[model samples]
Target: MAGRSCRNSIPVAFLVAVLFVLNPPTGVKSDSSDHRYKTNEDVPLYANKVGPFHNPSETYRYFDLPFCSPAHVKEKKEALGEVLNGDRLVVAPYNLEFLSNKDSEIVCQKKLSKEEVAQFRNAVAKDYYFQMYYDDLPLWGFLGKVDKEGKADPSEYKYYLFKHLHFEIAYNKDRVIEINARTDSNALVDITEDKEVDVDFMYSVKWKETDIPFEKRMDKFQSSSLPHHLEIHWFSIINSCVTVLLLTGFLATILMRVLKNDFVKYAHDEEAADDQEESGWKYIHGDVFRYPKYKSLLAASLGSGSQLFTLTIFIFILALVGVFYPYNRGALFTALVVVYALTSGIAGYTAASFYCQLEGTNWVRNLLLTGGLFCGPLLLTFCFLNTVAIAYSATAALPFGTIVVIFLIWALVTSPLLVLGGIAGKNSKAEFQAPCRTTKYPREIPPLPWYRGTLPQMAMAGFLPFSAIYIELYYIFASVWGHRIYTIYSILFIVFIILIIVTAFITVALTYFQLAAEDHEWWWRSFLCGGSTGLFIYGYCLYYYYARSDMSGFMQTSFFFGYMACVCYGFFLMLGTVGFRAALFFVRHIYRSIKCE
Candidate 1:
């Protein structure tokens, strides 16, 4: 045992070092800390990606449109996380001096050809918005506006491009605190013509001094729409708390009153019990401990669930501790991907141990299944989505080098750790222990009523848990799918706990009822019962897609459903494991107290 412990510590220590090196204190802000500047230091402005307002994920390079570029056309080298978030920051033509104001100055004169005009017209029709960064402060402006008023026919609709920009830069001491870009409707040019057009792009800069510190500058960008978000978040938290309390009440009632009575009744000798009644879960002691069929899959699912649950808690803790913030683009994704890969050992160890307990001998196959169970489907989905993004020429498509690096990380680091954990699990295995001995032959399950059937029980088991978190789900969906930023990790963590508790309680109740119905097949049923919450969540996703969101088009639709499917599938695994373990403990306790033979 000491040798095994020592061996495990080595890899764990290495993992910690690797994590520290990979994720430093560096935040989503630009690497440049040259905030303190003289009166006339040249501050370069970089333009980012542009995308349709409705489809946030489907973005293209800013220069993809017929926009004027700098004479040098220099691109800023972005971090891996930034690139993953589809940020393409390139130096723009507009040059500004610190604390210096400029009047309406012509940025560049451009003669747009027929193709360029068509591209601009298309961009305007889609309501594309552009983003730019000056001194690490982001600014946004629309490419054009659609005038729907005074137009009877759809074909007669007018598109007007905003040719001029007004920039406001706020400074405190020597630091740039805030920056904003605004377009005037008066300076709009009619882009309804498809022929060549000569346009002069113009911009004005106004500098203002303030007492606001540089550290607090990002707070303004946090949430402009906070009151509504706070109200909904509080409501959801209260709703989840009430649901958890009710579930706990049910558990307490069952454990204290009902189970206590059953324990006393069953404690009597067999003859005395037979004289009164021999019904309920106590009758199925012999078959309840029987190894479930397809136990390999169950083990793998449990292992994956364990990994996901830990990953979630760890990330939330990191978020709470300020490792990442809402403004940090791709930081969360980068952490999730890295942590999941590093924690492959946990999944392997868990799967191997459970499989061993079930008397499984195909260790190699079990290891492979444990490794690929979740990653296989996720990889396939990502690949398909990436292909679609590439075809659409969207910035969401990962570069070939990035893809190769990710693959290498998984292949080199994740795989070896999985094998090591599997080896340790196999070596430290113990025989399965059950309070009640299983009979050689399985017991026949009696006919159950409609309400007591597995499907109905599963439906009942899932609904309560889903109801607990459905409100929170809306906010989560909005933040991910829409433009809302999710900064409420504390609330999310609480709701997550409530969800696990609700799932465990509901699943255990169902398992108890199933056993009482003389159905000893509680293993897979308990898992599926808890996991059914994911089904309810997926159903809600359908409702949210149609009712709640304005998200349209093939790319956005596919991205939403595909990624949401993966998330819901993860919920299924994590909650299913919680249910299975809870039910197993409940069954063991009750059987042990009753003196199962």
Candidate 2:
């Protein structure tokens, strides 16, 4: 045992030593961009794989997609994201570097199928926008070898973003135009070698009909780089790790303190939680579950939205970590639907297994309904929309067939596990055996009544943070599905992680505040806590469309429609996530109270 442990330590120590010696990952000295988001400095593999191709269609694997934020002067981007409705919003940051292929053939070899080619051409002809599906565009999207995170081996072939455009002199500048193309003084460099430039250079074209010959032909040589936000870097990882560890530690401490407190357990006693048990819900005998009966449906919906908000964060985080990766294009929304669909077992099993010590329940229908209602609609909806995109030749079709394949996998893979979990959750007697126990007799849960219940309180909790972010959301959906050259993917990625943490904290704090104000029945309102943030996003999108953007053409109008589609979908997603989470809280509240063991 000692020898084996020593052997393991040797490898660990060796690895750490190597990392330290590297100091930086690559040999390239830090440039302006590398200072913020570091890039590996070694030359990537130069050759493209050729001949005897088995799975040619594998070139479009969703998992293999690469994206980066467009390069800007940095200052300009911060201003864009910080303005307008930002109270409840969490924004994504941008990335701003690009690399080139050693041999252009690597990208060229990534051939598209007949159908895809047809789709692209037809979509363009029909005035339909073919959004870049997954990572690459139909033709130009496959710029080079990919260089996403966790796959940085120097020798292996990887897709790279073309940082520089080689200006091919169609009419020879030296002979035809009577100027030197390569020289700094006279003409634009017509070279075969690709050089780095910012993506902004495309829009920031500084040419004129009448400029001096010295400057006109080859004046400014600012690096023309493109954006790729698919990868996360060392600094981001380090920053996130440090912050997440500290936050997690602090929250864990608070949870422990709350759990250990005698008053808290007593406050959660039985009758106080379960005065109105419906028999159908009895498998969860000690468990309590109730919606906040607000004065109106809108108010109740707000509380439900809070639930959706928190859950959305969870789903997005999972997607961000490459859990689903390129395998599914609609990973965020897809994950949401699936998680909500199977919550009944989790909720019921949690309540029944814990409150009555019954993890195995006879009420499979209840669990199915809980999870099914949420999951079924989303799958069907996406399937429908995906079909439309295909018909219209929209590149945004997002590997719809692939999505169906993955969904089927999830159903086959996850359904049984959920069912099994529910069975065990219902049958378990662990709660009774556990040394920890809840206090007996129901304490009067300070009567807010349904109208005065926790729903209103929950809706308010997440509203402000959501407001802070709505502006940011509008730009994102616009850029992704919209044809605008999205250049700030790195910033967007960082902002995404930050938003999740910020939103969750804001929601939790608000929910706690409402409860402390003697609103004991906060079941549905909890979801409202995080969910109400989306409304702020919707408002900002409208504002941007009206004020900031120049939507004069058909493309602009179409983009507007696409943006609206995303927002509406996003709204329902938020609403569903909030509802699901509140349902969990309600179940937890009741389970803790109803326990007699």
Candidate 3:
């Protein structure tokens, strides 16, 4: 405990010094601090060149996905109007292993296949069936083949039906090809028997020249236009605001249940010790000081929140650092996966230590739970989602070998750190103490009028704040990971900072108001303070579905992924803010109780 106290003192002192220097308390600047497109009233449909795709003099490169089938290549290329001859034309590659959106792959290199023509043909046709999951059917799947130049599995070959070749047609240009077998279709679901596959080879039917269209684009999340992003960001921001307020008030009601029974007076047998204690906050210092009733729950939440916050910050920083090079497309996730694996030490250490001390559960259970609760879920999500992508010939999918290596690293490196951190955290001192206080007996205070205890006023306080911003948030998540176009990340960065700050402050203020009003259940109220951000985000998504976005046939599975991601992000941010403030409140109350002034 002495060591823990020492560690905390240095950090607390450092934080206070930093806060004094920066004056961070008031709040961050509003959303407009960095928006390129000003005002929700006017949203421009398009912008001039800023990045690589808009740049001329670009080269067509080969995709390097392993296990690409030669047959699919021939069929796809012929559909692109390749005139078999000495004439050479740019074509996407068969194996698109490690290419980015900016770098196109060469998919038409000739190759041999030993697998039976019929069996292989059927497998190719039924690739979707090759991969399946509970309640999660794949939209599409394909059996890919790599070059077998130096191989013993030889087989009879069939001559090319037509000279195969294809080129990635960018969307902003006019159609330059005709009379080709276009197999392109953005089918979100598999085997929509009633609905015909509308095949079109033109730009509208494809994703960034690569076969794996939905890999890195945030569009799958937002509208492809700046106006759309702005619109949705605001919507989601508002939704979250409302959620924050509602939750803040809700939690207040729950916590105030303590007030319902005159908790300070009735619940304490420690009253006999009150005389030995100092004067201030003496009534219920021991038990009511931090409300130990939910320490287990609180610790779990803080663990998850810290993990998510760290992960998000890392991703944003990586983006700022240009890790997602134009030439390096789907590799963003690869980088993130590595960073995440490496950072498991932080997650494990933080969660294990915090949980062990707070929950007082077995240290081993605490450590394992901390590791698995976070890193484990991420790993599983990656595997399942990437498996689906691989089946659909989305070369961005992570390979089995990579997954295996990641797990090995996790076991070797992270598990140990988590165990140690748990031990250290368990031994740590509580950051704040409930002020020393004692009372001979409890005091009963009668409930105030209904208005004083009503949940309505606190709930209303969040509406304006929430209304102000859900649209903005909706577009950001959509734009970032939904495979949508987002050039104005600078603007997005501004809006994101503003939204979070506003959410935190507004929620806190609402909680304070309810407490003053004598409705003291602050737990859920604290959670809802930030939780409202989701409401605005989801609302913005709804608006896009109606007003801005035109992605009609996105599969149910995609919807599920999108929604789930939103919930996880929303809750994590909300709880982090709540936990931080509550910890602060605990400290303040403790000190006040001790002074008894």
Q: TM-score of every model?
A: 0.94, 0.40, 0.50
What TM-score does structure 3 among the candidates reach? 0.50
Most TM-score-accurate candidate: 1
TM-score: model 2 vs. ground truth:
0.40
Computed on alpha carbons, the lDDT of every model, listed in order, comes to 0.83, 0.36, 0.40
Candidate 2: which stretches are off by over 4 Å?
1-362, 390-407, 427-459, 467-475, 483-517, 544-597
Supply candidate 1's per-residue lDDT for 496.
Answer: 85
* Residue-wise C-alpha lDDT for candidate 2, range 1-597, written one tens digit per residue: 999989866733543333223222221112332222223222111111111111111112121122222243122111111111010111112111222112211111223344433333322222221011101101112232223357566334232233222211111211111111111122111111233322211101111123234222221211111222223233444555465556656755674475445245444543465664432222322222222343223222332233344444444444344333221223333444444433323443443343233222334554454344434555565566555545543333445344565567457744664566546756665743322232343334444455344456444544544543443465465444333333333444555555555455545544444444444344445555555555556565677666755444333344454445555545644543444444445335534543434
Query: For model 3, where is the 10-residue window of minimal lDDT?
Result: 78-87
Give the candidate order by descending TM-score.
Answer: 1, 3, 2
Residue 529 lDDT, candidate 3, scale 0-100:
50
lDDT of 3 by residue, 456-570 (tens): 5334433444455544545454454333344445455555555555556555555544444434345545655555455445555566555654333223244334545545554
Show pairs that collide, candidate 1. none
Best candidate according to lDDT: 1
lDDT of 1 by residue, 318-415 (tens): 66766566556566667777888888888889899889999999988999999899999999999999999999999999999889978998999889
Q: What's model 3's lDDT at 37? A: 27
